[model samples]
Target: MTTDTQTQPSSDPRYPVGRFHKPQTIDAVAIETGLKTLEELPRKLRNAVADLNDAQLATPYREGGWTVRQTVHHVADSHMNAYIRMKLALTEDAPVIRTYEEALWAELSDGKNAPLEWSLQLLEALHSRWVMMLRSLDDKQWQRTFVHPEHGPVSLQTGLLMYDWHSRHHLAHITSLRQAKGW
Candidate 1:
């Protein structure tokens, strides 16, 4: 049986860094690497959109997928939720986290037209606080679990790895689009 951590057979544009291969196991080394990815995400993301203008940002990375702009804002929105979830998981007993309609959220005004700098700056601050919180977690804290209404229980260790993969995934979307369009 294919598990969540297994990489899929094809390289779809929709999943640029490939689907997140949820590791079959979790350890300090794995968490450390995830932490590195989380720490570097802000800088890498800033560089991804550094030279794009409004017209370019509005272009879709794929035929029917979100525009580069929406992706940026979505990252901000999604990560904000994740940060809150982490907080909840730490203080509460297996708290069930809220789910969002990301597609609908992408269609909202700010998500579609907000300045890239806004999301970029938000990511910088978000990741800063996020990384700080993550770095302080002890062994017991790392095993904290949160229930996703849809996906069921998720441990902080797995969440860290998934979000780390998420950062690289979206970065590839922006960078691949730039390469394809010769931007």
Candidate 2:
């Protein structure tokens, strides 16, 4: 099981990491939207992420960039945080969540040197846990709120969407890198 402590800084401005976005409310999570996102995720991302060899996973996007391993680790970390946030919101009052420096976290040796196998295993387990958690949400749990230090109050439902997007986002990054290398 991965901890929620890891995160990566986004050099890509469009996907600023660790930022909170308000969710449209539990009533708005439209069953179709969640189901559609859920159905597409494994089908779309499995081959992109799973087919890589160890060397491919270790390949950094650029000279100073994070490898695929770090990206997946970031995913596990971020989702783990999301799950915890949901739990907290359901059990306690709107809690002010903790914040960390993503850049600093990703720069750690573990982030740079972690094996691809470690990250892949983390992803498999993390996604399993996340899906189970999301599926178990009641209407109230889905609407639970968390007070983010930077982004203010955001709903648990939005956090789920963020993770869904996160899965696709990093899958795209890895697939793009593979294409660039003509692998």
Off by over 4 Å in 2: 1-32, 35-46, 51-55, 62-64
Q: Rate the local accuracy (lDDT) of all candidates.
A: 0.88, 0.65
Structural similarity to truth (TM-score) of each candidate: 0.94, 0.73
RMSD of 1: 2.6
Relative to the true structure, candidate 2 reaches a TM of 0.73
Q: lDDT (0-100) at residue 67 of candidate 1?
A: 95
Candidate 2, pairs of clashing residues: none
For candidate 1, report its TM-score: 0.94
**Candidate 1: tens digits of C-alpha lDDT, residues 83-172:** 999999999999999999999999999999889899999999999999999999999999999999888999998999889878888888
lDDT (Cα, tens digit) per residue for candidate 2, span 1-183: 012312354667334344334333434434335534544554455566677787887887556767777776676566567768877887888999998766567768877677656656655666666667677777777778889999888777766666655765676677777777888
- Checking candidate 1 for backbone clashes, the offending pairs are 5-21, 5-22
State how far residue 71 of model 2 sits from its true place (Å).
1.0
lDDT of 1: 0.88
